[model samples]
Target: MSHYKKRLALLLLLLIGFVLVSCGQPATPQTVEKVVTQVVEKVVTQVVEKEVTQVVEKEVTTIVEVQVEPTAGPFLERARTDGLRVGFVQEKPFGYVDDQGNCTGIDIEVTREAAKRLGINEIICVHLAWEGLIPGLLASRIDVIPVGMAIRPERCEVVQFTDPYQAQGIAALVLKENPKNIHGFQDFVDNPNLKLGASIGASELTIAREQFHIPEDRAIGYSEQVQVIDDIVAGRIDAGMYTAPFVNRYIQEQGPDSALERATPFDSPSYFNTGHGFRKDDPEFVQLWNNTLLEMKRDGTIAKIAGEFGYTDADLLGEDAKVENCCSGDNWQNRACLPK
Candidate 1:
């Protein structure tokens, strides 16, 4: 119990009390700091993600706008200036190059009249083989095929065919004095030894095979029908199957001495119906063609051209002639005459 001892004890006791108070305080501030840091990091990440999503959405919208815009109208306008490049297959009265190298035929006349109506001045005609015409159109070598292309469902998958300009049927051409009682496709099928000549790749050949069951071995395929007619005149072939209008034109062009005479046409409605060909993407050009064809049929321009080419009975609105519903509906039966 000295004064110095009491002072030292008092100081020790104060130090111990200070240590106990520090130990008793809570760690709430550290936990709060950690939570605040995590919250800030989450907010920054969300902002970055939202900005990225906005940029991607904008890019997608711009691409969709570009894709949906119309482009065919401008392309067709440019084509008008350069003259619509047209192709034709030399199939005699329908389309052929004359000795003067001029594209002259029923199809040529029709196309000329259409061009005049459409205000198109230049028409560059390129002569192509019958099989090459479709390929030429796809390759952009030609803008239109103004040949007598028969519209079929098979052809529609590849090219967009305009409204039919003319409708016709399959007929057999024989010597005038021949005593064959052939009237329709059934007659040819019933007769066994009859030698039928047809031009290669011609629609008539397909018709004969599909309808008459004409064997490939019995049918002779020539490069051109003129050669087949020549063979028939020389007694090499029995008969030649071709379009009726074309047969008449050939006979007329060769004069009375030509032994070819068209037989009565077969009754199959699908064997007829012909139209011009175009590219699938050329909707504007096709519309122009369709409008021109309608006008020609109404104004008798088509009839006049048909007469010039020896199509005497060229009826634009015949019972079987359906040219209006070409690319419009699900009516496939009559569409043979109105090919799409």
Candidate 2:
């Protein structure tokens, strides 16, 4: 009985030990799987964090770059700057180079002063032919034309003109000893044998042809008004026609020995107004010039300049001189009443 009992107890104890070992093995496998799953989840979380950091860094960099970029506006990019360049034809009393090789004239003085007020230190003066002034402006070879250019309907189609700087009236010049007693356009046209001299590409020529009804052949075009005056003095032409200020300046500068005398203005009501020319799209430059001109007129700067050039009789502007059919003989007396 003792032997049987001992054997059974040993068998039961072995069986219990085996069950316990099996249960322990299954628990070890479950722990290993849980540990592996936790490790994989931790690695995935780290990768996701790295990707999110990279995306945030890129967004921050983009914001910084945008903040560093420059802003565009008028105050920062004013038109009157060192980059601005101006052009003009060498017309006396209006714009021309002085004997010192420096630019000095009414137009030059006005523009220089305006540029100074506008905080522009860089100014380039380019000399251009009178006829090519508009073309050079259109081609961007120059920024502005401050020459004594008149505002005409035909020219307005191409370029922008500032407010009137100086108003003018037309006049005819002839030799003092000449036999012709010219009063107006009728006198010019009535005499078919009379030859008229005018500057090429000048508004005066058009005015003479249209108002006086003179044939194109009888009207000779020269490059300059001085040439017309010279031709008239030399008896190469019967008469020379141009603005009153130019005629007065020529007479005063050359004196009586120049053999030229101004007759009464040809047409009544024919008034010409001179203004600065600019590119069509250059509104900033145009505004600057117009404001300067208005200031000059208000301060008597133009009158002072005209007085220096012996243009005392020359009106700075014509208020009522504009008359239709100014070329007719009936308006001859009316023309003289205009600003001379």
Candidate 3:
């Protein structure tokens, strides 16, 4: 309450006390008349004082509210001041920490370039498992998802994907010596003894289970790409499924004599592609992301970024993987969406 309000209340109490005192005492007729007139004047004055006090209180509150209210800036501007948060699975050839300990990968670089154009300099990378990406976006734990998460009908219903960054395929990561002679999914199905591994929550794992009918006992799932490869090196499984880009980068890093190799004649779907993810309700950010991606696609910036991580022209998605084509079907054909 304002000071004026407090003073009026005090005066009101004083007037009531004076009225009571006058009534209790035996007063002369002139004195009684004077007391009644004084009481009337005091009541009128108190009522006026209350009105003035209320007006003063309202004005004071308005002034304080105006002074404290914040003025929010644009998202990009705010991000530049703070950092742009980008979420990705904790896997290589997408988003991972390298030997130098910088959070980087093909998808990360692709997003970095796009963000740079949009005037967002710092990339705050949030590493998560495959299942956590969408949930993270939903919970506001992260802002953008730049990873190998392909667009599917069910996923489309929740979050919006950008024009695809690339059309990729699956690779059977195997031993360099080719002792198992495992070329593809057929090898695993043909030989009950052979075990296949894939990253958990990956569509490839689902396809191996549901579509390919690979026996559950023969199929192994790991939480991260690193786990799959580590187990593969340890000979826990005959071969593993990985994104072709990941395989390519792995082969480059590990060299010819490395313990792992891509099992070619690996009859895997080549049309499976992926794009950046955004919340459906955030259309403005989604548009800016899509526009940046389209520009990157047109100017060959995405391709250049991909080459640094072992991605070729064949894997690049220009018009083929636009978000418009994502819902046509879940099959990874020429349109590119299905699991390979």
Candidate 4:
């Protein structure tokens, strides 16, 4: 029996013994009833407090519990609240800050629209050096690079890309007088001493060095496009290079009195396709951009943005403009894979 039950048994035995001892004494039946009633009530109260009440309270406390959030949110969800930081180089038509200090271009507009639709409103534009764009992205200094970086084999090994957005042909820049008589990559080969100037880490520079076999010593790298022009004017380099649209824009902006001119008779068999460049690890986020770009393309939004930058529908990406088709081993920027 329980301790409380044993105590009750002992108390009953004691009460019986007392009753027998007081049999001949003046012990009334009313006094016996009152004593028994008090003993029973005390035992019941002790049992309720010790067994029922304590156990019930403990069970209630355990059952009425809630879970607390222990971890932080996902990166993309956090990005929705935080600003989406975008990286860009000062390349015309694709991305740039104008004389008025307004940041606008095809890539910038495309990024803005895509990010906005994805529920990210604030876009922090980060201007980086042309060569620093990829490294900065790898280092997490910026989020993405939509500055028309060509989706080439070398870049494919370093980072990832979306479907091709636009195509650009390589162009040569020279003095107005055409002193070097440079026309194409072959001209650079003909003059072994002819120093070629292109922005460092540019696909154009890669083409000159890798495709044309222009030796490293002959291929000079500059931090800016303007530096190439400066070195060319100073006669430190025999020729400079850029995309056709970029060189043409520079020529037009400089007017008729400009010292530099686009090297005429320069043409390419293929166009280098470019796209939105981002980190390889974030496949889901990259897919979001690709989906939005598809929407833009279907609704003529991409074409409209292109037109703003002097680009036409012809400049639009071809159906075969994918990463694999655009980049193949050492043969970077496959012309056969892209539109003419």
Candidate 5:
């Protein structure tokens, strides 16, 4: 009995000891293997998510940069951002405010086309007296002087000009009755008793006083062509002289029954080349206009505009016309009359 009992107790005690050691020790592979697998899966998932997020961010950034690069126009975008400010005189045949309050005529038409090609959305014309154009340009109040300004050297020294676009002869206006017998500019020169009428700041007065040797007292300057023509009609002055188209425009506008008539034998400082004027600082602007004008002339746009004002192609300058010395400078010499 003792031997059997001792063997069984010893076996039971050994088994109990083994169970207690297993409970106190770390987990076996069955539970621990699943936890390690879960941790590895989480790490891989985080790495893949981060890589995808970086690639998506880069793609989004590239797309934004590619969508923003255009709409700036040619040559000094800021200068014409608000559009051009053209200045014109209210002189017939070149520029004038019509009864409808619209600006019309040769110079205005030419300028409007150039402004359109330059990408300007607006053309604002400031009406100034003939004498005020140069000052208005220098003061920056005006961008262009498209008032059919003659390209005199004295004018060249102060402001800038586009290449000559017009060349013209001068004509005189007299009463239809021909009481004064003023057929041409020379008639005024020959008759000391006669007083000649010219617009203030016009090339006509300069030519009369300087080129023709007419005394200043015998020649008078009026502010507008109407003033000179009015005097001629009223007989306050013997004759009024200006560019041929100018006198013709007044006569035509006044109807067939008007007392004014074009005096015979047109005279001149001879072959005055006229151009639109601008500030000297505007070389780019002037060049732009020059190129555009040449293009217009070549394309027949210039001829079309001139024709509207009763100007023939002869009234327009050729594509290569340059300012010659015929009546070029402040001395106002008719180089044709000078010693060659």
Candidate 6:
């Protein structure tokens, strides 16, 4: 009994000890490690997905903002801050250098007065050829053309013109000898053999093309109006077409020896109007110039200058003169006129 009881008791004690030891020991490190690794992997995957989505959304939004918004050009600000660079060609009554080499003309004087009102500190006159005025302006070499550029449809596509300050009628400049008996542009139409002369890229060219149906080659463009007058006197051209007042002034200044006479006469409301030319980017400057021109016309300042050039109030803009009618769109002639 004693031996059997001792063996059984020993076995039971060994079994209980094994069970207690097994319960006291911690679980396998690999099991806990695997659970922690699974949790960490899930959190990492969620974070990576969130980050990728956020970055993609941010990039798309940035791209759209960059594409849609366009900033303004810096031209107007620079012009006002650094003063202005005005351009012109030597043309009587509009722009010319005086005997002293200082720039002086009706348009030049008007522009100077307008610049004074614009709070500009300085004005630099740049003398360029007529054909180069617009190209220079577009290239940023010049800020404006104060040569009294007539507002026309094709030019309006490239540049912005201030409200017209003056208006004038069309006429033909012919020799006093009356060789061809040409009185008007209509005469050129009647006699298709005669070639008419005008400055290149001028409203006269348009008139010859649209109204008279004259071909481009027959228009006979010269670089300058003086050249046309010279050619007319030499009989290279039968007649030269230009503004009536311009021809009159040329005859007056040339004296009786010029042998040039202004024959046909025309006036408003069938006239061409001119204003200062500016780059299309600098609209604010054009607005200020137009406002200043209006003030000059109202204050008799324009009249004083006009008298110097033999222009009267009739040449000056009427109070009701509208820029839209001048050359806003397709308003080249009767198409643009407002109802009386």
* Candidate 1: worst-modelled 10 consecutive residues by lDDT: 314-323
By lDDT, highest first, what's the ranking?
3, 4, 5, 6, 1, 2
What is residue 310's positional error in candidate 2, in angstroms? 5.0
lDDT of 4 by residue, 70-135 (tens): 212554675688777789988787789999998887789888887888898877889999989998
Residue-wise C-alpha lDDT for candidate 3, range 1-340, written one tens digit per residue: 3454445555555555566566785545565456555656676678879999999999999988755513235666777777778897767688889888899988889888888888888889888778888888876677788888877667888888887878777778888877899877777777889998998898778878887799777888888888888888898888889778778888878876888887765667445568888767657878987888888888888888888877767567666566766756646354355333
Q: Go through the candidates in order and give the C-alpha RMSD of each one to the true structure.
A: 15.3, 20.1, 9.2, 15.6, 22.0, 16.5
Q: Higher lDDT: candidate 1 or 2? A: 1
- Name model 4 segments beyond 4 Å from true: 1-73, 171-242, 247-267, 336-340
Candidate that beats the other on lDDT, 1 or 4, i.e. the better one: 4
List, residue by residue over 145-205, the lDDT tens digit for candidate 2.
7767656656767877766545567678887854687766677678888888888887778
In order, candidate lDDTs are 0.69, 0.65, 0.76, 0.75, 0.72, 0.71
Weakest 10 consecutive residues, lDDT, candidate 4?
64-73
TM-score of 4: 0.54
Q: Report the alpha-carbon TM-score of model 2 versus the true structure.
A: 0.52
lDDT of 6 by residue, 266-329 (tens): 3222566777888776576677778888888788888888777756565667556666666655
Q: Could you tell me which residue pairs clash in candidate 5?
A: none
On TM-score, the candidate that comes out on top is: 1
Model 5 Cα lDDT, one tens digit per residue, 122-198: 77889888898898777667778887776777787887777777776787788886777676667777788999989
lDDT (Cα, tens digit) per residue for candidate 1, span 1-340: 2443444444444444454457783436454344444544565567668888999999999977665523335545666677777798777787788899887888888887787677777778888888989988877777778777767667788888866756666667887865576566666688877777899998777767876688876677899767888888887777888767667677678787866676653444344467778877857778777777877877888888888887755323433444445444544344344444
Model 5 Cα RMSD, 1 decimal:
22.0
Clashing pairs in 2: 267-326, 268-326, 269-323
